[model samples]
Target: MTDVNSRPPSGTSMRPRNGAAKDAAPALQAVAEAERDRLIACAELLFFAYRDFTSDADKVLEQYGFGRAHHRVLHFVNRNPGLRVADLLHILQITKQSLARVLKQLIDEGFITQRSGREDRRQRLLFVTPKGTRLADKLASLQIRRIEHAIHAAGPGADDAAKRFLFAMIAPKDRDRVHALIRLPEALDTTEHLEQPQERT
Candidate 1:
């Protein structure tokens, strides 16, 4: 009997995790069933991984009285300055009213700037101010450090592999979008992870 948990050995083709993707290779019904089981296990692990990851950022966000929405807005804006509000809505997939509440707070606080679009008078282009960038960078460093610590603890190849898994989970079109927000995996070399110094300015 094949182990439900172990992925089929390299020589064997993998079954569909959802039977939705074009590339799913469930050669037999039994293999397909096993693949579904494995998918559930992966989902369970992901739930915990995401929970832990967000918790790390949550602490930082709380210190500034900003919530996760603020963090997401700032993070994306910093990554791609002058992004449109519509693009942000598409990226976040949140309702306009919800996003408006969070964005209005950030704009009111001077963390982000929304300018009238030159191309489209009806559209608003967003940018993170220097202050916003600093805060976003600091918040981002928390996750970066967490990932860096895990990667360093696991060593180099593991980091690349983890990033590949994350990108693979995203839709192909969104893969390019995800790549824009993050480095091309080579960014792991910028600076070795160590105890980060506190900002003093």
Candidate 2:
């Protein structure tokens, strides 16, 4: 066994002092500590970035008398055309009552339309109308531009790095759902379509 007392002095640790009493700390301990610190700092950065990223959309939603919840419902439904109510609620993880209220308002506003499923009478398939498409297009356009600018600033490598980081952050329970989404051809195709009003060419 290699003596634990031979570590290079250049690499000191910020962890609790117990590991350092000996001349050399375990190399693995240093690596773990560095990773742990990076994760913590990255978490804070993600929190701040998400807040700033959503602020513009929040303002637009407020003008339409909707909230972030409504934007989320519309955006997902818009992306996945003909999605069922049950599946939507599952993805959103919101109570039926809450979803019902938002769905009702969106339908009433002519932003979304619901059609009965041919196979299952109880199932309702939803889609966004031209009006909703317009709004969603605008909202999405802004985000696309933001993302494009970010990519330009950081170079294409950053986009792949960001995706890797995001995939790693998914909770174990949500991994299956995320996998299903990632495998979607349409999802990948439209992911870059992030415009306020997507051009349907």
Candidate 3:
């Protein structure tokens, strides 16, 4: 008599009980196809949105013989005065060599200045020059207008919904760090997480 636990012979196909395994293939395929469609839609929307969003800034930067890299460094430096190089690296997630090239151009053109850290002398803290501030503010205002128009078109409560969506889209591991970096106001910090209250338009 054959043992109840004996394995199936090699080269033989084994069917799962009740044909469940065979039935699951189509269901799994349908789910995968649906997910793929959703992802494709999201990816296309993001691509178009980013392309249009950066166009205005790109035009302005070209006039100054600068590129997006310069604009980014200038913008961050302007927003976070006394930004340390290390912190900038963390925020930008770029290599030191890439940052150095852009930073050198800005520094040489008098768009940015660096000074030793007050507490830690070895740390280089970055600040935007007056000229840099003007340019950065201009670039920001252009983007802000675009964002405002888009949010308004999206309808009431759209701004809050959009913010939630954007925050959720961030990588889980980096969300906490990003929240801390942005530093939402205390009154708006009702949640333990970084879901901020809607701004009074």
Candidate 4:
């Protein structure tokens, strides 16, 4: 006469103290612990990889009395000449105040130059000075050698896999924009054209 769906009375227990549920708890806990260990391993690997990747550049920057921020600003400006301030802010995803501080140092040090935008005089366009270009190239070469060695050690197809992995790490909403920003030939090309002396009037 008892309904199967009825709840147990307030004073009565539905599950035994040593039931199947209690027995499975340890198994679930073990699985969770294993997964956490795997995650920690991956995290540590990424931390070490990034540390080594940037170490060479960090040493170079120190000689100039600059930091990573200066390196990033110089790199982008050198690669994308006439880049707008607004675009740099968007690409770097940093606040105007932070950009201003690093930017002022580069400008005062003769590593960067700003010109009024032809389309909008109110807008400031960024360009790397000759000194900036040399420093940027040197910094880039150091990093490139490290990357080439890593890729070579990883063997064929490793470069493509690494690129895919990095692209996938970008947020879905921002991926398209990132692709557009990074896809430009001007950004990647370092050829005779770039090495040509600027024609000064």
Give the best candidate by lDDT.
Answer: 3
Better of 2 and 4 by lDDT: 4
Worst 10 residues of 3 by lDDT: 184-193
- Point out where model 1 deviates above 4 Å: 1-37, 180-201
Task: State the lDDT of candidate 4 residue by residue for 2-69, as single tens digits.
Answer: 89899988997876767778889999999989998997998898899989989999999999899988
Better of 2 and 3 by lDDT: 3
TM-score, each model?
Answer: 0.69, 0.73, 0.79, 0.79
Q: Which residue runs of candidate 2 sit more than 4 Å off their true CA positions?
A: 1-35, 182-201
lDDT (Cα, tens digit) per residue for candidate 3, span 1-201 = 988888889976566656787789899989989998998999999899999999999999999899988998998899899999999998888999999999999999999999998899999999999999999999999999999999999899887777667766776667767767667544433245655445543
Error of 2 at 98 (Å): 1.3
RMSD of 4: 12.3
Q: TM-score for model 3?
A: 0.79
Q: Scored by Cα lDDT, where does model 4 land?
A: 0.85
List runs of model 3 lying over 4 Å from the truth.
1-24, 185-201
